[model samples]
Target: MTMAWGRSAAVGVGAGAAGVVAMTLVEKLEQRITGRPDSYVPARTLERLLGLAHARGRRAWLHNLAMHASQGAMLGALRGVMAGAGLRGPWASLMFFAVRLTNDQTFENASGVGAPPWTWPRDELVVDLAHKAVYAFATGVVADALAVRWGPGPGQVHAEEFPGRRRHIGPPPRA
Candidate 1:
């Protein structure tokens, strides 16, 4: 099956809205766990994954959102391929999540935005785990959609990996 931008847009907007909801829920969960409002930034996660230090305004958010949609389509297409190959159930989901997490984390580390291994505290693992869990599901939705669209037949998942790559930004001004 061919990739349709219209369907992709719907999935993207839908997934992004879902992502916002998921982020909100994660914040509430974190609050319940630790008794304070969660202040983790989604943009930071995405930026770190993209190996960027800072994206200061609305333009950055728009760029990130588009990048997300493109990534989502690729994941969905991969899911479709796996399903087409007869994979199913929880394992399929696990594989898709693993692909995204490993790729994202690896990219973050490779691009120099990831936290240094030695700097990671045990407490931080909880937060990271929470982020991974939510993103895993959201990514799965993307993967599933793509799989449905491109998994069964001749085509592969065609979403771009990182859309319109940004050059490094100037360092932020001192507070």
Candidate 2:
């Protein structure tokens, strides 16, 4: 039987949390090397949602932290469900990368805190992609690990017509 969504989501939380942590560490390390200034998208989105103005000091840092972590955890749940359905490996990570990027852009654009991606400077774009890639692949690794307990998910099951995984079409094609 297929895994239930509830269970998938639960495992996803764990996976997502692990992914976020990894992503955070990577970002911190990269920041030291590249001397890149922090992007304010997460903090801006939080402020918009909370109906608060741009903040500074401990308050802004807290908001930024909360937004980053929460977003990662929630997105991880989505990736978890995907893995539960048999979407794993690089293919799944690619899809998840798109999802994560889209999620962030949607929030930023909708909140009017950011402009379209095409409008971003090349350097900013690269930095964003680098960070998101870490999160996407990290989430995929964790989700795949958790879902492995249940075996190849529902989609991996071969259809009836593909029985025994026969490779020769119509009795071997006489080659």
Candidate 3:
């Protein structure tokens, strides 16, 4: 029932990368339909974080790609850990969606590279949420599949023991 941290994180990285690919495709399609310009906030944020000079053209695009890929891989680790802990399926992905949003907003705002989501136009917000949702669900799918080899997680075992009871729930019994 113990969580396999190393393996989980590795799998999560791969899952996250897959998620980024999926999200990118969704964004491209959406952009083509909506005629939305690419947002360079990610690249700007990376430049700020690294104290690098401002980049334009190909450099900015590269920065954007790097940020997206690295961020996805890193965050996917959390999703992987969740799967390893038996928090799989759509519910887990839903939870991860919130986490992903929070992480982005926190860094973007703190870095002064982006504004808060509440300040964004409704359409923009919707697009952002949709894209992130794609990433979360895709990542979750991969993490869940990879973690299945470990069998049910401790949380799953605990749930089976307690069923629908809500009150006076205690720690799961020792293995």
Candidate 4:
């Protein structure tokens, strides 16, 4: 039950993209209801990372879209790897949601394009978390589906072999 790293990553990319699409749709709806302006932190972060000058107007919008899509697709790879390891279901998606938030904070803060989550308004934080959760669970769904071709992951196998064992039972046998 070895993990197929390459295949998993490839599957993840696709899953991530799908997750981004789902998130975007949700964001759009939420924004329409709340009249929340689009956040351009992603575009700013991308510009800083690429040593490009700050953009405005339509250019900024394009940059934002590019960053949003690429980042989601890239993160989806992690979810795919999780699925490849048999970490499927809502629990796994919950974990991935944390990962997604961590990744965003890390990059956004490091680039000095965004403030810490604690500094954000309560409503803003909630909106952000909701969007990321959507991405995580959506990506998880895709990754879990794609990884089915590889059968149960090592973790699943281990769970079956040692349902309630408290002792270290060692790794599951190789397939």
Per-model TM-score, in order, reads 0.49, 0.88, 0.97, 0.95
Name the candidate, 3 or 4, with the larger lDDT value: 3
> Runs in model 4 with CA error above 4 Å?
173-175
Across 1-175, the per-residue lDDT of candidate 2 in tens digits comes to 4567888888888888888998999999999999987766799899998899899978888889899999999999999998898888889999999999999999989999888898999988888888899999999999998898888776665333366656663422222
What count of clashes does model 3 give? Answer: 0
Error of 1 at 119 (Å): 4.8
Among the numbered candidates, top TM-score falls to: 3
Please list the C-alpha lDDT of all candidates, in the order they appear: 0.54, 0.86, 0.93, 0.93
After aligning candidate 4 to the native by TM-score, how far in Å is the CA of 73 from where it should be? 0.3
Point out the worst 10-residue segment of candidate 3 by lDDT.
165-174
Candidate 4: Cα lDDT at 15:
98
Task: Estimate the TM-score for candidate 1.
Answer: 0.49
Candidate 1 residue-wise lDDT, 1-175, digit = tens: 3344555445544453454356457756887978864332445556766666677678567655655544545555555455444343466667766776575566556656566534778676667666656755664555455546544422222212223545663433333
What candidate 1 gets wrong by more than 4 Å, as runs, is 1-54, 116-119, 137-175
lDDT, residue 96, model 1 = 62
- Residues 1-175 of candidate 4: C-alpha lDDT, one tens digit per residue: 5788888989999999999999999999999999999999999999988999999999999999999999999999999999998999899999999999999899899999989999999999999999999999999999999887889988888898878867867876566
Pairing residues by index, what is the TM-score of model 3?
0.97
Model 2: residues >4 Å from true position, as ranges? Answer: 159-175
